[model samples]
Target: MFDLAEIIDIPPFSLDRQKKGELFTRALSDLTQYHQQNCHEYNQILQLLGGSKNSFSSIEDIPFIPVRLFKEYELLSVDQAEVIKTMTSSGTTGQSVSKIFLDKYTSTNQTKVLTKLVSSFTGKKRLPMLVIDTKAVLKDRNLFSARGAGILGFSMLGYDVTYALDERMELDWEQINAFIQKHKNEQILLFGFTFMIWEHFYKPLQSKGLQLPFENSILIHGGGWKKLIDEAVDNETYKKRIFEVTGIERIFNYYGMVEQTGSIFMECESGYLHSSIFSDVIIRDYKDFRSLGFGEQGLIQLVSLLPQSYPGHSILTEDIGELLGEDNCSCGRLGKYFKVHGRIKNAEIRGCSDTYAEGKK
Candidate 1:
């Protein structure tokens, strides 16, 4: 029995598409049946959708549940006693949030895969960390909203970590200036949710006419682009504005949901999001669910080998995106690259971001 979960921690993190394809096919096929056999609800959906009940050869053959199902049901393959934590997605304006149960193995694997992904982008050595969100987000140990989970997950990559926002969710200028002065002229790592980085950190500093000289910093931000789009801030504008305000230019925007945390797609300088080895992305036509060719925008179906405790390994998300190409990026990274075009219209608006991006208090 090939345990599909093994690949997430397997060695040789080098870029290899041939190896990735074989591993991805088998792992996804095995995980599909694993969830089907253990999670009755998932199996029922598979049968309902006419999905393969056995190993799959094509990634398109994998059946996926709509991400919203997590909020409506507790779908777990592991026994109750095995659950070590329950993570919740960030709540939208009025919609219910997803509650994902995580066992020790699943949680540990998620962290490990995330570590690999981050290390690939921001070198192996840990750097001085500056988080753009307030310190209060980490209070909940059991239930992690998206922002809370993000802070905790990335906090593992750095030492002497400092929060950039204060209790009021406002920029902590005194603390930030002090921290910058303390770590001046050193490589630094920064993490934050997208909206908060713009609204809370970038805007305040820009308005007050202050600059940090973080030319040696690398920032990783994701989540809640809906809010950014609301403000007419495209990725280019966002990056340009940030560069004007601060000297930092090494910024990478990633795309992920609480449903599939470990299998994130991060941006490279080529301006496309690259799929990691542990996961693959497919764009499906809205009506027939068939795979669309490159540059064709459609719904994003994400497949991962990371979720063993919950039936979240493969999910049909509400986001619209297009797979750009494979192994041909200017940044010199391997694997398929893609672009997200925000969420599908009329999908329930829910994310772990503040409403402030829409000009609301």
Candidate 2:
């Protein structure tokens, strides 16, 4: 059986390649059979794919379904009455959105794992938080989009949380200035979507000839890199410009999707996204879905131990990435470290930042 508590109790990046493989192969194999027995639709899909319920020798031997399946079908292993929340993927006006149902057990575990992973970077102390978006995004308590979920997940790490923008999505100078003055001598935390921080926060602050003294603080942003890419902005340029505007030298960008909300791949100081002990990433050949070795760019497949209410334990994402190495990063973190190269060529532009940009226009 897969003991989530055992995995959660372990340090996020403490396991090396061999240890992580052994742990994940057992847990994921058990989870596969559990889902097969509980979810009829999932079982049918596995039966069609000829997936056996027996133990998997390696992590790569486990069958994975396309991530898009969530958008098309309601895949859940728990009963509907047990669901406490429903998380939706970010999308533009008429696009389909994925609905992920979460029961109490899955919801609580997600929060716990997220806290552990994020605290590995930002210490366990909760700091004053400055969110780059408006509070309006979190108005809906029952149904949360990826943007809202991200904010809520990170909000638990901060105290005296304040929004940097108003309900209209405009920069709230008064609110921001107050937050800065109150926490001037302390190291604070800032959170936001990548494009929102760039478009709504950085650009506006720069154009107005304003600068903030946030050198003592850290900023964590992710998602919507696709929109920034369209504007010809790369990661280095984004980091440089953000530092120029906010003076926050410590900025970490994470990579995650709504399907696996808690188990995020956080970028290390060496600028590589790392897989933690609770989750792992595998690059696959775009043509044959064969697992690719390190340094080869291909589709990204993600596996996590966080989803029990749903069969999202293993999913083949549409994003492109390359496995840089295992247990050998300069940052000294164990497990796999890799880099995401954006979405597949023809994949839809459906990140949180891109959706917000389109809706505003």
Candidate 3:
């Protein structure tokens, strides 16, 4: 079995070059061997690609399965009865969702890792959380969707959580007003997907001159710029408009996917998506899958040492990104930092923060 403790025990973004490479490569090799021993499909793929624990030399040389393979296969290293939770990816109409089955150890450790990552940015205090989505998302305990999973996972950061939207996808201004009026003097955390916070909450209120008590709060958002791109709302414009309403300047956007749910890559104050100690990112060429240097755009391949129950540790994602630099970011955090350009051209439009997630939450 994969060693969950070894991977999760590392402090956030503190690994030097030698230690980071050593730990990451060792954990990747362990995950590959564990999955190959238990998952037949994964073993076949590794054998087909001539990959083995004895063959890996560096973190970059680790074998990566296409992320789409999850949608086509049940790639679990554990028994069906051992699955404690199943997380499904957001799928557009007619697209098949990827099912990620998690066992107890994997599930517990994943959420623990997520808490560590989030708390590292938002501090150890459990601030009151303001969720932009409706409360109906948590209605289902089984068959967890991406939006619901994200909400529940992030909810660990706070208590007395307030949902700002009603079930009909309309603003619950009365509740929001009451929530802010209650927590007006306290330091809080505002959590939401990117487009949801804008379309469902920010735009409606901004048009009416409505402002919340966010002067002392922090905004943590994830997902990408495609929807806002279509609406002509880029990051700076979105941040400026949000500041106009809330006076919030400590906004941090994260880059993550449902497959690698726990190892979220967050944008630091210096404006780069950083891989925490448990994860790493690599940019590869579209033509022959060669690794690219800094400032070159290519397919984004994400590696997470936290996937113990599923064969998702090393995944070649469909998103495009550029490796900015390693340990050179002004924020002073270690590991690789990069930029996600968004889904590859002609790729499927997915993720909850992208399109409000049709039929997802």
> Could you give candidate 2's per-residue lDDT for residues 1-361 as a string of tens digits?
7878887888899998888899999999999999999899899999999866679899998999999999999999999999999999998878899999999999999999999999999998999999999999898899999999999999999999999999988999899989989998899899999999998999998998888989889999988787788899998999999999888888999999999999999999999999999899989999999999988999999999989999999999999999999999999999899998888877877678878877778
User: lDDT tens digits, residues 1-361, model 3?
Assistant: 3476765666789997789888777778878888899999999998899767654678889999999999999899999999989999888778888999999888888899899999999998899999989989787787888889999999988998999899987899798889988887898898988988888889888889987768888999886568788888877898889988888899999989999998999889988899988889989999999889999999999999778789999999999999989987899898899988878878877788764644443
For candidate 2, what is the TM-score? 0.98
Report, for every candidate in turn, its global Cα lDDT versus the true structure: 0.83, 0.92, 0.87
Which of candidates 1 and 2 reaches a greater lDDT?
2
lDDT of 1 by residue, 26-58 (tens): 778888888888988888888888756577777
- Candidate ranking under TM-score, highest first, comes to 2, 3, 1
Per-residue lDDT value at 141 in model 3: 81
Off by over 4 Å in 2: none
Off by over 4 Å in 1: 4-17, 354-361
The candidate that wins on lDDT is 2
Error of 3 at 9 (Å): 4.1
Cα lDDT, model 3, residue 19: 90
Poorest lDDT segment (10 consecutive residues) of candidate 2: 345-354
The deviation in Å at residue 154 for candidate 2 is: 0.5
Model 3 alpha-carbon drift over 4 Å, by segment: 7-9, 357-361
Residue 17, candidate 1: how far off, in angstroms? 4.3
Give the CA lDDT, 0 to 100, for residue 38 in model 3: 90
